[model samples]
Target: MDYLDLKYTPKEDIVCTFILKGKEDKKTLSSKIAGESSTGTWTKVLYSKKELNAKVFSINKDTIKIAYPLELFEKGNIPQLLSSVAGNIFGMRGIDKLILRDIDFPKKYVEAFKGPELGISEIRKKTGIKERPIVGTIFKPKLGMSPKQMAENAYLVFSAGLDFAKDDENLSNQDFCKFKERFNLITKVLDKVENERGRRPIYAINITAPYDEMVKRAEFAKENNGNCIMVDAITLGFSSLQSLLSKKWGMLIHCHRAMHGAITRSRDFGISMLVFAKLLRLTGVTELHTGTVVGKMEGSKEEVVEINNFLRKEWFNIKPIFPTASGGLHPVLMPELIKILGKDLMITSGGGIWGHEMGAASGAKAMLQAVDAGVKNIPINEYARTHKELESAIKSWKGFEKENYNYKIKH
Candidate 1:
């Protein structure tokens, strides 16, 4: 059956753009993609409906845009939606490579799901950090930290003017640090910090587990006065995320994209990080880890900028997500990060803090000072001249200037 409709314009359909490379002709491959994703078989089906077929309405060389009828998807069901569009088409024969570059959901479909409960502005209000980028850190030596050690570190950073802290992606209920024990200790430390400093910093406790267990952990956190939770969004699956968001706990959901590189790093195959970011926003994550362009991440400056913009831009009733810049970040790179990503961001560092020459507290001070310099548009070197913590941090961590990363934001 012919799937291409050059004259068609998609109004209410879920439009997807894909890049396909195959031995079969472009027309044939595009037809197969539309058919297999929607409602066609290898042999002519005994019964079929023309209205259900996906329409390949636009094509430019190897790039094609296929629009699926909104009726094909169940309301607010991401698993079914992904299965229909992103599934089955990958393993098809004769197709050498395929990439799902981007997707656009109609207003009707987009409004069906609940987006972030507390988006960027609300989060800033809650944290009371208005102008500067929110500064945070991941616990270094991701695994094997005892509960006491973890709580002590939390106390150090939270008291040192850091706005946020999170458990590393791999940290979850190890023998050395049982979940309940760690939660108890950290919450106590946070309470102590709030009492002493008059500001309560956010601690994103990892509650990523099996669905039922995850729910139980979330309940535990809620019962014990926890304000935020983190999930490895990809590994936990979108269904779980939807269910968790549906609970309306009103807590900040920090999404850690741990295994995204496997799918997003490849240029010739698999899905794009942009698609993942959109879906996460739709599923209601308060904050997500978009790449740090100047840091040690796979995404380029342009790609990272695009993803960050999409996360924070207006979409129907969906609130803007706080784009988190993480992975190999340090105090030295603060100016470059704030310049490229803007001030509405969460800058997280791990080794950048804990690996400091003095200690974690000093490192936190240095990071905050660097952010202050960046916000005031002062040269870090010039600012460092008077700030002892920043000067020490610069002495310890150098070489960010040599990367020479640059980007010009488009109006």
Candidate 2:
């Protein structure tokens, strides 16, 4: 009776065909989309007292099959309702999908997952960033650092008072940093932070590698230590992520879509990240990258918020996942980022942090300062008067001055 174990698929325009089970001695139900026998054979019936149309119905034993108009279950409400009811008894093991035309979206079921576990409030409580997106940076670009070096940087990143840092997507073994060695080293650094800071800065070590190697690493990391596991899912593929996320772990599933834009970014596009966002959650990615609005990738503010909503929206009882906004980001953009993304997000800067005049650690500190400015709704440069890191960074590029809107796509 654990509804979380089975989520119903009322995908757009598709008829969900579920093989009825139990109390029945062997039941056969025919299809009806909005009460008309769109197909060859079906026994029809009315549901709930709606007379204009035969909305929904049920079957009994092997002799009875009742079909209803698809409109009664409009807005995907019918499907979710069906799943909720069916899953409570039948489970989602074998349900077939049917397509619906002129289908209306279920407004009632729209914010179905509207609740939050560690929503913006809880994420803030956990990381201590009250207003702006939490600062995150990855120690990856080319991905050729030794485990010791990676661990060393992890220690410095935590020591500098920044919130979180992670291993780049491609940081697996290649005559350089092996996954085990790096995970082991960084995990040790996490323990150090835990003992000192009372709460350790999360380290999302890359678990993305060849299939066998990747699972091997994920299993190892889950069993051993680390705050979370990072995966370049586009490279690993959709199903692959599901496989890895199946294992238990305390850390969040940190995702870096190294090649996602190839399919999602086109105007007349292949598919929407919105679609992928739903699928990603089904597959269990707790944190996903939606690119930054004003950063290098050119995603619009609307696009950014839309994707963020998809990630955080309560889908079943699943823990709310955080959206990571990166791409050519720096600390200065935090205010605009927060205004659009709300608070359940993680903002990461790379060269913007690594190349800071004060140093990588200070750059991170500056990013945190930028977030504080956003939460407090103060000017970044003005915040600089007090926070040294913010002041130094503002003296240079002044990342806070840029427009927070998406740039027009040139192509």
Candidate 3:
């Protein structure tokens, strides 16, 4: 039953760091966490193996680090890994709050899973956008748009020079906009735009449904010349995301964290977005919605930066995921977002593009102009003076104010 081991180095183990708060003392709660997550039970079993038990190697204040043996987790199974490290322990006795802060996977474990089929660089090459953050927009009026209307809207933005367009996380095979019809229409629009502009823009069609349905939709997209597919990663579950990635459809996988707030919003309990980002990267999502620091999202600058860094950094042979900064973002906020997140990002806006004073095309132009100004180190207002779209957007949105950044807009 004794799981504490200050001397353990954890060479080949899956090490997890957790912040736990409970009625029991730190040592007792930490041991309980180690025991419940790996081996050992409430009362000592008739048999036990010391090697299989997770060891609490480091404990600092309310934070504890538990190293689990590699054998305890299946090689490429994300669900099994979460079941061991992030399971049962949450509802255990004497625990009031628990947050899974981070996890360090051994090389052997990391290599077992298939990473991104097309990483950041490959995507850039395919999209023909060598520099500047990739610009995109979520289909506004997130619901109620028919397949033809959706395709027309996509054409407006793609022809206006945006790098990509996607379905909002909630949009799926609704009765009004069936998945196959939507995909067919949008791909045709993208093809037309590509022929005219000489650069194929990405269309991340949302294919989040049951496993078999999702696979069918993905195959449909692949056959119809779709370049990207979007999934509600959190809602669909990591196991489904991994399965989709393993298919190697040669389409970019865009991960939308739709229900992440339920699990990650609380600072005191549940899991951190950093952990989610790592698992998503390991599961091989080409792009993931991290957060927009100066936008309507809840994540701070430091936390978002850390999560984005982990997604893009080198992790054994796993391909780096493109960090997407979205939610309540717009033309005026582009400079600040680019400054904080750098060029290796996907700048996604919803109402920001659709709510423009002129129209969606003008709105799309404004977003691109703002990104151009930010990338060139030009002041947005000064740049807007020469660009009517940016000027209209600044006036329409009342410009970007750091003090009023978090004000919610109807997205």
Report residue 62 deviation for candidate 2 (angstroms): 44
lDDT of 3 by residue, 145-215 (tens): 99999999999999999998999988999999998889889888988998999988999999999999999
Clash total of candidate 2: 16
> Cα deviation of 337 in candidate 2 (Å)?
1.5
- TM-scores of all predicted structures: 0.96, 0.69, 0.97
In what order do the candidates fall by lDDT, top score first?
1, 3, 2
Candidate 2 lDDT tens digits, 1-411: 111112233433222222333231332222222223232213434342333332233333322223333344433232343332222322222323221101122334333432222344455676666645667787844576788987887776677776778777666666787778778888888888889988778777787877788888777877886557788877887556655665566556777888767766654213456655655655567678886776777577787788788677655555567898887677767777787787778877776677688787888788877887888888777888889887777676553333532543212
lDDT per model, in order? 0.90, 0.61, 0.90
Q: Mind giving the per-residue lDDT tens digits that candidate 1 earns over 1-411?
A: 467787889989999999999998888899999999999878786678889889999889999999999999998999999999999999899988899999999999999988999999999999999999999999987998999999999988889999999999988887989999999999999899999999888989999999999999999998998989999999999999899888887789999999999898887789999999999999999999989988877788898899999998999999998999998888899988899999999989997888777899999999999999999999999999998888998987777442433322211
lDDT of 1: 0.90
The RMSD of every model to the true structure, in order and in angstroms, is 4.2, 11.5, 1.7
- Give me the candidate number with maximum lDDT: 1
Ranking by TM-score: 3, 1, 2
Better of 1 and 2 by lDDT: 1
Mark the regions of model 3 whose C-alpha exceeds 4 Å error after superposition: 399-411
How does candidate 3 fare on TM-score? 0.97
